[model samples]
Target: MAASAYSDHPELCVKDNFKQSNFKRRIQVQCDLLKEDQCSAFTAISHSDKAIILSFRGSEEDEVTMEVVDAITVLPVTEFSGKAKVNQYFYDAFNDLWNAGIKNDFLSLKNANPGYELWVTGHSLGAAMASLAATTLVTTKIFPADKIKLVTFGQPRVGDKTYAELIDSIIPYAYRVIHKNDLVANIPPQFLYGYHHHKSEVWYNNDMTKGQPYLECDEDESKKCSDSVIDLSIPDHSMYYNVTGSFASNGCKGWNVFTQ
Candidate 1:
């Protein structure tokens, strides 16, 4: 179920060229840097299934900017009623976009599509934003916690232990999927930064074989999980959604796979 959410991202990126299939409403979201910093995402509604998907795009600009944002340590979740703390940069970025009408837009969509199940997803930086968005949705009472589902690929640690506990308890179905050797998954070093991920992880091994299966790691934060192990490489981060072939050897990038 979670993996399928990721598969929808490629189509969501094709804004102008998008063809409305199962999705009845497609809202393109790109927060101008002057207005709300660099935040971009899209929300689509599937009336047939009563599902609302909020997908965020990965970094498409300067890598230096992304590194700077990722380094913004920790801050309290004071923006809402939660006692938990989150990555300052992620929260600030998400807050800026939310305040710029994304929140109201989402709420309006929710009201318009009553009874629709909300699913949030993204990759890389987008995944971090998605996590913050999910947290905000629950914290603000815009929607009941259980009514939302979050599934992110190559997601970094968004908050501290308390924040992890809070999200895990509230969101109900949060799945963080990591591919083997994907360095982005081991970001914001836990020991050095005191960051932690939410409970429940789905790990796919490096070796892709006919019978190879994804492992479900221990849900407890103390477990550390497979993602806790250090493996800093960007190629793995881009290899998801059944994409095969060596990215480096083929002179191709992950984004190329999606764009092509």
Candidate 2:
């Protein structure tokens, strides 16, 4: 597909006027895993369309932060226990993002384009937060039903079937792209509650460490999974977004879409 196929909507990629103090505040947060050596390297840059991109480097890897055009929310990931608290924390984090966008200064940017859509996305833990944030916005009617969407890479289950059902009932378009052999998504925290959820497509691959290029599943691999599952093994967990674009571009609308 041509690069022009993807609409460069203003709200999808907006920039933020970040100050030096924001970095200080990020470091001050005691519980945040983003803490590092002497200097706190976290930075939030707003895209022209209004979405905020937060980038930071940890001891071994780097992390990217996301904020939608109309919603400049942060992920409140304080704990990891499998409880309603995890759900509520995600809810609060998303609410904060919504509040950020509508705040006095943030409102000016949002009102500049009333037709803009709010989106949240991430990779790894960030992807998990994106899923939670999207669910919260839809459940609370924070944004239009179909207008909100989520694009996550290697996301895990947020809650039980009830939570998934709540998310499915409200959000019309949510896509979770899983790379082949990505063990993170397989953890299945929500499945423990008897809430079985599957992906729209499982982009698999032979080696994820190299480039993680995406590939369609062979006939044999697809049969190993039940009809309930779409085993994507192309990208092999790491390189889900290949040169051909991510799984989202291939039309995997997720379990929420087809079920409804």
Candidate 3:
């Protein structure tokens, strides 16, 4: 296809360009379980030539041990829940670590590579961190403000309506992925808040509407909501490898696949 021909059809051109650009990006992730004083934590950093994803798992238990348990305690939980105090602490922790990681990467890449894009993703608490990191990246101009994307899976409500809107405004590609019946999504942050203003969709399991956590209100908000959000219930709350697509796959195993 000629360049002029593509320019005439801008949407097609952009899609084609993104598809081609996906292969040029590099993928880098760091997973670590650390112990400090009386707490145990897990942190994972997944980056690509185009984007970056950082996740931190909370303590497995109240004891000081290095173990990554898949229980609710070990995952990231958003703020604005009934337990506001605990939620804020985790949110601040994720922000501090994420900012450090992003600053390191952004500074290192600033001189040699000036225009790389960015995206952040995570399952639960990780998802909330990813969203906040994405916003922070744009707000600080560490990455291209318009190029930042957020894909959160089964993320609890991070904040109220204003916070969600602030997040959405910083990046154009913010997307929150919800499963069909996953109860974690509805825990606290009700859907009416402004912070949940970004694009959202439901990921189905076997059937379209059978067994997954579903977000019913995003359609009325996002002008371009996807048909599905990719059901994360199949393998429990971990949808790390299922998201597939140039923008999503990032070479992950299952939940990373992009589903239309």
Off by over 4 Å in 1: 1-37, 61-69, 72-79, 207-211, 218-225, 244-260
**How many clashes show up in model 3?**
32
Give the winner by TM-score. 1
The TM-score that candidate 3 achieves is 0.52
Tens digits of per-residue lDDT for model 3, 149-247 = 566665656655556656655566766665454444443433322223344544443223323343344432342332233232423333323321222
Global lDDT scores for all candidate models:
0.63, 0.38, 0.41
What tens digits encode model 1's per-residue C-alpha lDDT throughout 1-260? 22222332433333212333243332334433433435555556655556777766554435524544544434435444557767776676666666666676677778887888888887766688888899878876888887788888878777778778888778888888787767666767677456787867887775433456777874844344565556556676766756522222222233333345
Candidate 3 — worst ten consecutive residues by lDDT sum? Answer: 1-10
Instruction: Assess the local accuracy of residue 115 in candidate 3 as a C-alpha lDDT between 0 and 100.
Output: 62
Root-mean-square deviation of every model: 6.0, 12.0, 11.3
Candidate 2: tens digits of C-alpha lDDT, residues 1-260? 11101112211212112121111112111113233211111222233433423221111122222212101123223232332223332344334434443223323433454655555555544455566656554555545667665666655554455455555566666665656565445434333434223333345444333444544332211333222244533234344434222322333223122133
Q: What TM-score would each prediction reach against the true structure? A: 0.75, 0.49, 0.52
Model 2: lDDT equals 0.38
Q: In model 3, what lDDT does residue 96 have?
A: 59
